[model samples]
Each structure stands twice: as structure tokens, then as C-alpha cells.
Target: MITSEKIKIYAHYYGDSDMWARRAKSSEKAILSNDWYLIGSLIQEIELVNKGLASEKFTLNLKKHLIESCDNQETIRQLESLLAMNK
Candidate 1:
């Protein structure tokens, strides 16, 4: 599940209600499609970008979640590659 913390990160990154609303709609679509992994990854990436080391482990875990949740082989491969690089 995509958390409020993640949504907050999206909201913060976008920096406007309209943009945030659009993101929220997209997030809802992702959720409905069971593609929450993408949203989770995106949020974690934003958190890492904004907070750096404070979010390193959190981002890594989110990447793991992406690995577990992703159905697309290419996406899983890319995420695995990223996780390996991060390690």
C-alpha cells in the first residue's frame, strides 16, 4: 500500500495543490491497477533526493518492495540492478 508519507513527499516535490492533485489521481490509478510499487519507488526516490542519508535505508527498503511487487520483468531487472548498485 502507498502510504501518506509517500503522498506527502509527492505533494512536497510538486509544490502545488493542482500538481499534487494530478499526482494523487495518478497514484489512485496506480493503486487501482495494483502498480503501487511504482508509486512507492517514486516516493522513496523523492524522499532520498530531499533528505539524503536520512532516507537511505527507507529508499532501499522501498526498492526491495518494488522488487517484490513488480510484475514486469524489465522493471524488476532494473530495480534489481539499482539495488545491487546501491549495495
Candidate 2:
């Protein structure tokens, strides 16, 4: 089970984006089933569709969650390393 703290953090990362939050919040159960790949896909969709649009703070918070919830060390490292290339 995903911790409540993580969920809260994710929700904060989502902020006031109702559509994105709704989609992600609805899929919360499926996301915790060790299906990190699907979660990654969902994240990518959110990033692409909402890219260059979210506030800097929200984007950074979202990126933090992505790094924290990534399936493995490599994925976490990869995402964190990309912070420097934020567009």
C-alpha cells in the first residue's frame, strides 16, 4: 500500500490541476500495484500535455515525487539528473 504521506505529496504536486489530479487520483490503486511502468507512462502524459504550463514550484514538486516514487535507483537517478535540463 502507498503511504498516506506519499499520496499527500503527490496531491500537492498535482496542485489545482483538476483534470490531471482526477485522472491520477482515480488511478491511485492501479498505480500502487507495482506497475511503475504504467505510472511512468501516466506521468509522461501529464508532463507532455501540461509541459511548460505548470508553475515552477508545481513542476519541481511533481519532479520530486517522480524521483521519490520511481521503481528503482536508476530511474530515480535518471529523473533527478534531468532536473538540470528542465524546459
lDDT of each: 0.48, 0.47
Off by over 4 Å in 1: 1-32, 36-54, 76-87
| Least well predicted 10-residue stretch by lDDT in candidate 2 | 1-10
User: lDDT per residue, candidate 1, 1-87, as tens digits?
Assistant: 444444334334343335444656665444433433455455446456445655668767766665566555564444333432323
What TM-score against the true fold does each predicted structure earn? Answer: 0.31, 0.34
Candidate 1, residue 76: how far the Cα is off, in Å: 4.9
Clash totals, every prediction: 0, 0
Which pairs clash in the backbone of model 2? none
